[model samples]
Target: MARSSTNQNVHSADDSSLDAGGARALRRGLQLLDALLDAGPEGLRVVELCRACALERATVHRLLATLQASGYVATAGRFRYVPGPRLGRAAAAPGQPNMAVRLQPVLARVSAAFGDAAFAIVRDGPHSHCIAREVGTHPVQVLVIQVGTRQPLGVGAAGLALLSALPDAQVQQIVAANAPHLAAYGGMTAERLHLLVRATRERGWSVIGNHATRNVLAVGMAVRDARGEPVAAISLASTLARMPRERQQLVARTMREALAPLAV
Candidate 1:
């Protein structure tokens, strides 16, 4: 009976300690940590972190200081904070496959079905970077784009496809700001770009006619995540001389079908 009473008293004391330590600021700090973990290598700024986690600047700063001192985070410059080596080690220890790694098989299937080069690209500011690509089984193909290559957001089929997926106001802003570069690609004027975006939205895909290479045609569609926001774009490029109108439509349809199950 005495031992049972002692154990109950200890449990009560532990609960009280936990309740005392669970302040609002501490809860906010944990939220910020979760956001950082989700962001991966692309760190967040103080303002963005605070906005995303709904914490005040002062509270976040204090939390960051504590986390940094404990070696969980590393801050650079005046704004950016990324997970430190300890966090990265923990993340990599499980040896679980990442999204890009799992996506390789799907990309291969798309390339096999279309018989044209297929690319998966993610947006990075004014440019989009090719994260993965599967080369087609063609004798002569556009071999310039490789993994990690960055292209202007309005230059190639992949870029235009992604741009078209964005909201009209956002597309217009990007096009207007990039007007000078648009002139290089004939008929890529802001008005023309807007028209193309409208057409892409209507068609549920985008196509560019020999803009990058003389006789190459490209068709692409944006892939969205669970939030209905575009995470990346997949595209197929082939020589216009080889791919007839029917074949082009088939390729577009096949690509869309392949991506349908993965769509949000």
Candidate 2:
């Protein structure tokens, strides 16, 4: 897990950076948000938060009160704060400049390699969303996925790669959560998903055939964030005839090369 980062609005240049009046308050407020983000879905109590952010109890309370009113934080208990519903609502909204725009060029490069469609997928809660895509120029284009398509985090090759990169405990948690929903997709069970995740880990990538979509095969690898966490992935999808085991390896290597510079 990422350490409770306090560098968001603080840790900048000294007093000359901004006007003296409300700057300190702003820094403290951002520190509070950072600490709360690190606490995860379970959240942290007022006392725990105070210790994490190194702020006074009263100041933490004041900030929490303000944050709650602004829909940035929500109380789990009398003194605990979890991320608010507004954050989730904002996440699915389409107006923001998103990963697809940044990755469009990279996706084009991957698609060009073998005339197979490519996708950029990002983890959103327990699902991996196709945020960007580039269609191959081949006569038979494999449109396995498109921008805004979403699948359970362990379902598709791209999603499985992302899931395999997560910790074991978190993997189990997601398995449990998605187990109930998997039946609707294809009678997929958590146990089956677990097996795929393990295989993906050993292979350092994921490959799927006739699973999510029949006759379509895909190769995927996770991309790490600055924190070294798998936040996204790139995938190449084509007909099964085009993506043999040897070709899968080749495509994966190509994906790594094309996406390496973009990860930064």
- TM-score leader: 2
Q: Candidate 2, residues 1-264: lDDT per residue as tens digits? A: 233344532544444466664788788888887887888855678898889889999999898888878877765423457676456456654764556676788889989988988888876556677888888989998887788897778778888898899888667766776777786655678888999898999988998767778888899899886678776788889898888889999998888888778743
Tell me how candidate 1 scores on lDDT.
Answer: 0.72
Strongest candidate by lDDT: 2
List clashing residue pairs in candidate 2.
none
C-alpha RMSD of each candidate structure in angstroms = 10.6, 12.4
User: What is each predicted model's overall lDDT from 0 to 1?
Assistant: 0.72, 0.79
Q: What would the TM-score be for candidate 1 when compared with the true structure?
A: 0.62
Question: Which tens-of-lDDT digit does each residue in 123-176 have in candidate 1?
Answer: 654456787888877676665478888755656777778888877645655666
Please provide TM-scores, in order, for all candidate models, with all chains considered together.
0.62, 0.67
For model 2, the superposed segments whose C-alpha errors exceed 4 Å read: 1-35, 40-98
